[model samples]
Target chain A: MRGYTSDKDGYLTRLRRIEGQIRGPQRMVENDEYCIDVLTQIAAATKALQSVSLGLMDEHLKHCVAEAIAVGGDTADAKVREASEAIARLVRS
Target chain B: MRGYTSDKDGYLTRLRRIEGQIRGPQRMVENDEYCIDVLTQIAAATKALQSVSLGLMDEHLKHCVAEAIAVGGDTADAKVREASEAIARLVRS
Candidate 1:
């Protein structure tokens, strides 16, 4: 099981909400809504996505990484490296 | 008409593609995909959203904000302040 297994439903709900947030802007653009207003909505959605990423990162560190470290082997080293890379991508994105 | 009027179709297309990107991860989660893989997809979608915001911001500055500044009045000040706030939010997010 993945690190987020326990909170699977919560993550899915947030993701679905974000999908709606993204779609709303398309409608606003279609109707020629004010640029600032559309930007505001997009910012909100972006923040929401950021929040979700933080949550997933936390869970991954707490569970998956923790478990791998407990084993103390090449797998542990690889997992740590992989998690660091993912964090870097999230930060850069 | 909004600043993005000329690129409405392009923006819509990108937004629709982002919606799909967001949805793909839900399925990945449901299938118990690896944590890093899911996080990678989320980062990609987040980056795509950020790109769209940057594009909209550029258009807003070049068109709406430019026109308001060219008119030289209180409206220009308001637009500049508003755009600054939007930029701050995007940066924070």
Candidate 2:
């Protein structure tokens, strides 16, 4: 949380770039671009998205999760459940 | 990016919960808990991780990637490349 303010700007900047990537395919679709080309763009967008997620997950583990373990309280169990549920959703997706 | 500040607090809280969940398995391992239990916890942690990644990815598509396409510049190509590389890493990982 302490570092949140410091990192927020960079995170948002990266996200904005990613948002543009996501929209590329939609535009392609609207223009009736080649099937393979649109699919390729879609694939690219998906990967870009996964990258952002990976970075966030890494931060969460290092900061929030690590802190919870250090503190050792009810928060610990809640964190575990929260993480587990998140993983389940990812795999399903 | 504008929405970043608005959502920051909620995101941090969720991340903290995930952080605690990640450490649960580590503790279980250190305490010599049941083998199945440890593995189960590890699996849970992984799932939680995936969930966090998925959520962030979803947001990136909605925000960052989407916005880039709207702007229509060299950023468009850069965004596509950035996204593609990220996906490649995820699939490999």
Q: Pick the candidate with the highest TM-score.
A: 1
lDDT of model 2 at position A18: 76
The DockQ values of the predictions, listed in order, are 0.88, 0.03
Q: Give model 2's docking category.
A: incorrect
Q: Which portions of model 1 miss their true places by more than 4 Å? A: none
Model 2 has a DockQ score of 0.03
lDDT of 1 at B70: 99
lDDT of 1 by residue, A1-93 (tens): 899999999999999999999999999999999988998999899889889889999999999999999998999999999999999999999
- How high a TM-score does candidate 2 get? 0.48
Give the clash count for each candidate. 0, 24
* Clashes (candidate 1): 0
lDDT of 2 by residue, A1-93 (tens): 632445788778888987888788889889999999988877887766766665665455335544554465677446545644554344465
Q: Name the candidate that leads on lDDT.
A: 1
**Consecutive 10-residue window with the lowest summed lDDT within model 1 chain B:** B29-38
